[model samples]
Target chain A: MKIRPLDDRVLVQPLEEIESKTSSGIIIPDTAKEKPRIGVVIAVGTDEDLREKVKEGDKILFAKYGGEEVEIDGKEYRIISRSDILAVIED
Target chain B: MKIRPLDDRVLVQPLEEIESKTSSGIIIPDTAKEKPRIGVVIAVGTDEDLREKVKEGDKILFAKYGGEEVEIDGKEYRIISRSDILAVIED
Candidate 1:
Protein backbone atom coordinates (compact mmCIF):
# COMPACT_ATOMS: atom_id res chain seq x y z
CA MET A 1 0.00 0.00 0.00
CA LYS A 2 1.14 3.51 -0.75
CA ILE A 3 1.33 6.03 2.07
CA ARG A 4 -0.57 9.23 1.57
CA PRO A 5 -0.44 12.11 3.99
CA LEU A 6 -3.59 13.82 5.14
CA ASP A 7 -4.22 17.55 5.20
CA ASP A 8 -0.89 19.37 5.10
CA ARG A 9 1.30 16.39 5.77
CA VAL A 10 4.11 15.00 3.62
CA LEU A 11 6.08 11.82 3.26
CA VAL A 12 9.86 11.89 3.26
CA GLN A 13 12.68 9.46 2.74
CA PRO A 14 15.72 10.43 4.77
CA LEU A 15 19.12 10.62 3.18
CA GLU A 16 21.90 8.82 4.96
CA GLU A 17 25.10 10.54 5.82
CA ILE A 18 28.36 9.28 4.42
CA GLU A 19 30.27 7.25 6.94
CA SER A 20 33.12 9.10 8.60
CA LYS A 21 36.50 7.49 8.51
CA THR A 22 39.56 8.41 10.55
CA SER A 23 42.91 9.08 8.94
CA SER A 24 43.91 5.60 10.08
CA GLY A 25 40.95 4.11 8.15
CA ILE A 26 38.86 3.30 11.22
CA ILE A 27 35.09 3.68 10.78
CA ILE A 28 32.90 5.42 13.30
CA PRO A 29 30.29 3.38 15.11
CA ASP A 30 26.57 3.95 14.82
CA THR A 31 26.31 4.77 18.51
CA ALA A 32 28.08 8.07 17.90
CA LYS A 33 26.07 9.05 14.85
CA GLU A 34 23.89 12.09 14.88
CA LYS A 35 20.39 11.99 13.50
CA PRO A 36 20.07 12.99 9.86
CA ARG A 37 17.92 16.02 9.23
CA ILE A 38 17.68 15.94 5.46
CA GLY A 39 15.33 14.02 3.22
CA VAL A 40 13.59 13.92 -0.14
CA VAL A 41 9.90 14.59 -0.46
CA ILE A 42 8.07 11.55 -1.65
CA ALA A 43 4.51 12.72 -1.43
CA VAL A 44 2.60 15.81 -0.37
CA GLY A 45 -0.80 16.46 1.07
CA THR A 46 -3.78 17.39 -1.05
CA ASP A 47 -4.26 20.76 0.54
CA GLU A 48 -4.28 23.35 -2.19
CA ASP A 49 -1.94 25.73 -0.39
CA LEU A 50 0.49 23.02 0.53
CA ARG A 51 0.50 21.60 -2.98
CA GLU A 52 1.42 24.97 -4.33
CA LYS A 53 4.44 25.35 -2.08
CA VAL A 54 5.87 21.84 -1.99
CA LYS A 55 6.16 19.04 -4.50
CA GLU A 56 7.43 15.52 -4.75
CA GLY A 57 11.16 15.04 -5.42
CA ASP A 58 12.16 18.17 -3.52
CA LYS A 59 15.03 17.77 -1.10
CA ILE A 60 14.28 19.26 2.27
CA LEU A 61 15.81 19.93 5.63
CA PHE A 62 13.54 18.75 8.42
CA ALA A 63 13.56 18.70 12.19
CA LYS A 64 15.64 15.83 13.59
CA TYR A 65 12.89 14.52 15.82
CA GLY A 66 9.98 15.46 13.62
CA GLY A 67 7.60 13.06 11.87
CA GLU A 68 6.37 9.56 12.54
CA GLU A 69 8.69 6.79 11.35
CA VAL A 70 7.40 3.95 9.28
CA GLU A 71 8.91 1.14 7.28
CA ILE A 72 7.60 0.70 3.77
CA ASP A 73 8.68 -2.22 1.66
CA GLY A 74 11.64 -2.46 4.03
CA LYS A 75 12.62 1.17 3.47
CA GLU A 76 12.21 3.69 6.26
CA TYR A 77 10.09 6.74 5.67
CA ARG A 78 8.79 9.59 7.77
CA ILE A 79 5.34 11.13 7.70
CA ILE A 80 5.49 14.76 8.71
CA SER A 81 3.14 17.65 8.65
CA ARG A 82 3.98 20.74 6.65
CA SER A 83 5.13 22.44 9.86
CA ASP A 84 7.89 19.96 10.43
CA ILE A 85 9.65 20.81 7.20
CA LEU A 86 12.47 23.32 7.73
CA ALA A 87 13.67 24.34 4.29
CA VAL A 88 13.91 23.19 0.71
CA ILE A 89 17.47 22.52 -0.35
CA GLU A 90 18.12 23.42 -3.94
CA ASP A 91 21.10 22.15 -5.84
CA MET B 1 17.36 41.76 21.87
CA LYS B 2 14.49 40.82 19.63
CA ILE B 3 14.86 37.82 17.34
CA ARG B 4 13.75 38.00 13.76
CA PRO B 5 13.86 34.86 11.68
CA LEU B 6 15.52 34.99 8.32
CA ASP B 7 14.08 33.79 5.01
CA ASP B 8 11.05 31.66 5.74
CA ARG B 9 11.90 31.04 9.36
CA VAL B 10 9.61 31.80 12.29
CA LEU B 11 10.08 32.43 15.98
CA VAL B 12 7.77 30.61 18.35
CA GLN B 13 7.01 30.59 22.05
CA PRO B 14 6.02 27.11 23.15
CA LEU B 15 2.90 26.82 25.24
CA GLU B 16 3.20 25.01 28.52
CA GLU B 17 0.80 22.16 29.09
CA ILE B 18 -1.56 22.26 32.01
CA GLU B 19 -0.58 19.79 34.67
CA SER B 20 -2.93 16.85 34.70
CA LYS B 21 -4.38 16.04 38.08
CA THR B 22 -6.21 12.92 39.11
CA SER B 23 -9.40 12.92 41.13
CA SER B 24 -7.14 12.75 44.17
CA GLY B 25 -5.38 15.93 43.02
CA ILE B 26 -1.91 14.57 42.35
CA ILE B 27 0.35 16.64 40.12
CA ILE B 28 2.24 14.96 37.34
CA PRO B 29 6.02 15.38 37.38
CA ASP B 30 8.03 16.96 34.62
CA THR B 31 9.88 13.76 33.86
CA ALA B 32 6.74 12.21 32.44
CA LYS B 33 5.75 15.27 30.48
CA GLU B 34 5.69 15.02 26.74
CA LYS B 35 7.27 17.78 24.69
CA PRO B 36 4.77 20.39 23.67
CA ARG B 37 4.20 20.40 19.93
CA ILE B 38 2.11 23.53 19.88
CA GLY B 39 3.29 27.13 20.13
CA VAL B 40 2.35 30.69 19.42
CA VAL B 41 4.02 32.46 16.56
CA ILE B 42 5.98 35.36 17.94
CA ALA B 43 7.46 36.61 14.67
CA VAL B 44 7.36 35.63 11.06
CA GLY B 45 9.94 35.68 8.31
CA THR B 46 10.20 38.36 5.65
CA ASP B 47 9.59 36.06 2.71
CA GLU B 48 6.52 37.19 0.86
CA ASP B 49 5.33 33.68 0.18
CA LEU B 50 5.62 32.72 3.82
CA ARG B 51 4.01 35.88 5.05
CA GLU B 52 0.85 35.09 3.15
CA LYS B 53 0.51 31.75 4.88
CA VAL B 54 1.46 32.58 8.45
CA LYS B 55 1.06 35.58 10.69
CA GLU B 56 2.15 36.73 14.09
CA GLY B 57 0.04 35.52 17.05
CA ASP B 58 -1.09 32.46 15.16
CA LYS B 59 -1.03 29.24 17.09
CA ILE B 60 0.65 26.38 15.26
CA LEU B 61 1.59 22.76 15.56
CA PHE B 62 5.25 22.03 14.88
CA ALA B 63 7.74 19.28 15.06
CA LYS B 64 8.80 18.78 18.64
CA TYR B 65 12.52 18.70 17.91
CA GLY B 66 12.55 20.86 14.81
CA GLY B 67 13.70 24.30 15.90
CA GLU B 68 16.78 25.81 17.50
CA GLU B 69 16.28 26.80 21.11
CA VAL B 70 17.27 30.19 22.43
CA GLU B 71 16.51 32.31 25.47
CA ILE B 72 15.57 35.90 25.01
CA ASP B 73 15.12 38.18 28.01
CA GLY B 74 14.72 35.04 30.13
CA LYS B 75 11.92 33.71 27.92
CA GLU B 76 12.44 30.53 25.94
CA TYR B 77 11.72 30.55 22.25
CA ARG B 78 12.44 28.44 19.24
CA ILE B 79 13.58 29.48 15.78
CA ILE B 80 12.28 27.21 13.06
CA SER B 81 12.08 27.28 9.31
CA ARG B 82 8.74 27.51 7.58
CA SER B 83 8.88 23.92 6.48
CA ASP B 84 8.87 22.69 10.06
CA ILE B 85 5.40 24.03 10.73
CA LEU B 86 2.72 21.37 10.55
CA ALA B 87 -0.66 22.97 10.98
CA VAL B 88 -2.38 26.06 12.30
CA ILE B 89 -4.83 25.54 15.12
CA GLU B 90 -7.97 27.60 14.93
CA ASP B 91 -10.01 27.64 18.07
Candidate 2:
Protein backbone atom coordinates (compact mmCIF):
# COMPACT_ATOMS: atom_id res chain seq x y z
CA MET A 1 0.00 0.00 0.00
CA LYS A 2 1.46 3.28 -1.17
CA ILE A 3 0.64 6.61 0.46
CA ARG A 4 0.76 10.01 -1.20
CA PRO A 5 0.10 13.42 0.19
CA LEU A 6 -2.15 16.04 -1.32
CA ASP A 7 -1.16 19.63 -2.11
CA ASP A 8 2.08 20.62 -0.40
CA ARG A 9 2.08 17.83 2.17
CA VAL A 10 4.64 15.05 2.34
CA LEU A 11 4.71 11.50 3.63
CA VAL A 12 7.56 10.78 6.01
CA GLN A 13 8.81 7.60 7.63
CA PRO A 14 10.27 8.43 10.99
CA LEU A 15 13.63 7.04 12.02
CA GLU A 16 13.80 4.68 14.97
CA GLU A 17 15.39 5.95 18.12
CA ILE A 18 18.55 4.31 19.32
CA GLU A 19 18.15 2.08 22.33
CA SER A 20 21.11 3.81 23.93
CA LYS A 21 21.00 7.31 25.36
CA THR A 22 22.98 10.36 24.28
CA SER A 23 24.42 12.81 26.82
CA SER A 24 23.25 11.90 30.30
CA GLY A 25 23.24 8.19 29.37
CA ILE A 26 19.89 7.99 31.09
CA ILE A 27 18.06 5.07 29.60
CA ILE A 28 14.70 6.50 28.60
CA PRO A 29 12.24 4.07 30.01
CA ASP A 30 8.88 3.93 28.24
CA THR A 31 7.55 6.30 30.91
CA ALA A 32 9.65 9.44 30.48
CA LYS A 33 9.26 10.43 26.85
CA GLU A 34 9.15 13.06 24.16
CA LYS A 35 8.21 13.04 20.51
CA PRO A 36 10.28 11.55 17.68
CA ARG A 37 12.51 14.02 15.81
CA ILE A 38 14.09 12.29 12.82
CA GLY A 39 12.51 10.99 9.64
CA VAL A 40 12.93 10.31 5.88
CA VAL A 41 10.93 12.03 3.16
CA ILE A 42 8.92 9.38 1.45
CA ALA A 43 6.61 11.32 -0.86
CA VAL A 44 6.56 14.97 -1.93
CA GLY A 45 3.47 17.12 -2.35
CA THR A 46 2.06 18.53 -5.57
CA ASP A 47 3.16 22.13 -5.19
CA GLU A 48 5.70 23.10 -7.81
CA ASP A 49 7.67 25.55 -5.74
CA LEU A 50 7.79 23.12 -2.86
CA ARG A 51 8.83 20.38 -5.25
CA GLU A 52 11.72 22.61 -6.27
CA LYS A 53 12.60 23.11 -2.63
CA VAL A 54 12.58 19.45 -1.58
CA LYS A 55 12.66 16.13 -3.31
CA GLU A 56 12.01 12.49 -2.52
CA GLY A 57 14.76 10.38 -0.85
CA ASP A 58 15.81 13.44 1.16
CA LYS A 59 16.52 12.75 4.79
CA ILE A 60 14.93 15.63 6.70
CA LEU A 61 14.69 16.80 10.26
CA PHE A 62 11.03 17.47 10.81
CA ALA A 63 9.17 18.65 13.87
CA LYS A 64 8.72 15.81 16.34
CA TYR A 65 5.01 16.53 16.22
CA GLY A 66 4.08 17.79 12.77
CA GLY A 67 2.09 15.49 10.50
CA GLU A 68 -0.91 13.15 10.70
CA GLU A 69 -0.23 9.46 11.22
CA VAL A 70 -1.45 6.82 8.81
CA GLU A 71 -0.70 3.14 8.68
CA ILE A 72 0.38 1.81 5.34
CA ASP A 73 1.69 -1.68 4.84
CA GLY A 74 1.70 -1.89 8.63
CA LYS A 75 4.30 0.89 8.67
CA GLU A 76 3.64 4.28 10.20
CA TYR A 77 4.01 7.41 8.07
CA ARG A 78 3.09 11.03 8.45
CA ILE A 79 0.96 13.06 6.07
CA ILE A 80 2.01 16.59 6.74
CA SER A 81 1.41 19.88 5.06
CA ARG A 82 4.28 21.77 3.45
CA SER A 83 4.57 24.56 6.00
CA ASP A 84 5.69 22.23 8.76
CA ILE A 85 9.03 21.31 7.26
CA LEU A 86 11.98 22.85 9.06
CA ALA A 87 15.21 21.92 7.27
CA VAL A 88 16.43 19.43 4.70
CA ILE A 89 19.39 17.33 5.77
CA GLU A 90 22.37 17.43 3.39
CA ASP A 91 24.49 14.58 4.70
CA MET B 1 10.67 34.36 25.71
CA LYS B 2 9.27 34.59 22.21
CA ILE B 3 10.32 32.26 19.40
CA ARG B 4 9.77 32.80 15.73
CA PRO B 5 10.42 30.40 12.88
CA LEU B 6 12.48 31.35 9.87
CA ASP B 7 11.72 30.99 6.17
CA ASP B 8 8.52 29.11 5.40
CA ARG B 9 8.31 27.64 8.86
CA VAL B 10 5.78 28.46 11.56
CA LEU B 11 6.00 28.31 15.32
CA VAL B 12 3.33 25.99 16.68
CA GLN B 13 2.28 25.37 20.28
CA PRO B 14 0.93 21.88 20.64
CA LEU B 15 -2.21 21.18 22.60
CA GLU B 16 -2.21 18.83 25.54
CA GLU B 17 -3.96 15.51 25.30
CA ILE B 18 -6.81 14.54 27.55
CA GLU B 19 -6.15 12.20 30.42
CA SER B 20 -8.81 9.84 29.17
CA LYS B 21 -8.70 7.56 26.17
CA THR B 22 -10.54 7.75 22.84
CA SER B 23 -12.20 4.66 21.40
CA SER B 24 -10.86 1.70 23.28
CA GLY B 25 -11.27 3.48 26.62
CA ILE B 26 -7.96 1.98 27.53
CA ILE B 27 -5.82 4.24 29.61
CA ILE B 28 -2.62 4.75 27.68
CA PRO B 29 0.07 4.19 30.21
CA ASP B 30 3.00 6.53 30.29
CA THR B 31 4.87 3.67 28.64
CA ALA B 32 2.71 2.81 25.64
CA LYS B 33 2.60 6.22 24.04
CA GLU B 34 2.64 8.20 20.82
CA LYS B 35 3.40 11.79 19.83
CA PRO B 36 1.08 14.81 19.99
CA ARG B 37 -1.47 15.49 17.28
CA ILE B 38 -2.96 19.00 17.74
CA GLY B 39 -1.44 22.47 17.93
CA VAL B 40 -2.10 26.16 17.46
CA VAL B 41 -0.27 28.32 14.92
CA ILE B 42 1.63 30.97 16.76
CA ALA B 43 3.97 32.81 14.38
CA VAL B 44 3.71 32.88 10.63
CA GLY B 45 6.73 32.28 8.42
CA THR B 46 8.64 34.70 6.21
CA ASP B 47 7.68 33.27 2.88
CA GLU B 48 5.14 35.55 1.27
CA ASP B 49 3.10 32.83 -0.35
CA LEU B 50 3.16 30.65 2.69
CA ARG B 51 2.22 33.51 4.93
CA GLU B 52 -0.67 34.18 2.62
CA LYS B 53 -1.75 30.58 2.90
CA VAL B 54 -1.60 30.44 6.71
CA LYS B 55 -1.77 33.10 9.34
CA GLU B 56 -1.19 33.79 12.98
CA GLY B 57 -3.79 32.65 15.56
CA ASP B 58 -4.95 29.83 13.37
CA LYS B 59 -5.82 26.58 15.17
CA ILE B 60 -4.30 24.01 12.90
CA LEU B 61 -3.94 20.27 12.71
CA PHE B 62 -0.38 19.35 11.92
CA ALA B 63 1.31 16.06 11.26
CA LYS B 64 1.34 13.94 14.44
CA TYR B 65 5.11 14.39 14.26
CA GLY B 66 6.93 17.35 12.53
CA GLY B 67 9.45 20.14 13.59
CA GLU B 68 12.18 21.03 16.01
CA GLU B 69 11.47 21.66 19.68
CA VAL B 70 12.22 24.93 21.43
CA GLU B 71 11.52 26.28 24.86
CA ILE B 72 9.73 29.60 24.99
CA ASP B 73 8.15 31.20 28.04
CA GLY B 74 9.01 27.91 29.71
CA LYS B 75 6.65 26.16 27.32
CA GLU B 76 7.58 23.75 24.53
CA TYR B 77 6.75 24.70 20.97
CA ARG B 78 7.51 23.10 17.65
CA ILE B 79 9.17 25.07 14.87
CA ILE B 80 8.10 23.29 11.74
CA SER B 81 8.27 23.88 8.02
CA ARG B 82 5.07 25.02 6.37
CA SER B 83 4.81 21.72 4.55
CA ASP B 84 3.89 19.92 7.72
CA ILE B 85 0.55 21.61 8.15
CA LEU B 86 -2.32 19.39 7.07
CA ALA B 87 -5.44 21.54 7.51
CA VAL B 88 -6.49 24.78 9.13
CA ILE B 89 -9.27 24.57 11.67
CA GLU B 90 -11.96 27.18 11.12
CA ASP B 91 -13.83 26.84 14.38
- Enumerate the chain B TM-scores of all models: 0.77, 0.75
Q: A1-91, model 1: which lDDT tens digit per residue?
A: 7777999989999776441121112222333233325678899987877787778987665666787999899998999887677555444
Model 2 stretches with alpha carbons more than 4 Å out? A19-36, B1-91
Segments of candidate 1 deviating more than 4 angstroms: A19-36, B1-7, B10-66, B69-91
Worst 10 residues of 2 chain A by lDDT: A19-28
State which docking tier applies to candidate 2.
incorrect
Q: Candidate 2, TM-score vs. the true structure?
A: 0.45
Candidate 2 lDDT over A1-91, as tens digits, reads: 5666778898988766652123112222333245435567898988777787778987655655687998788888888776566655444
CA displacement after TM-score superposition, residue A5 of candidate 2 (Å): 1.0
TM-score of chain A of each: 0.78, 0.75
Work out the TM-score per prediction: 0.47, 0.45
| Cα-based lDDT at residue A27, candidate 1 | 23
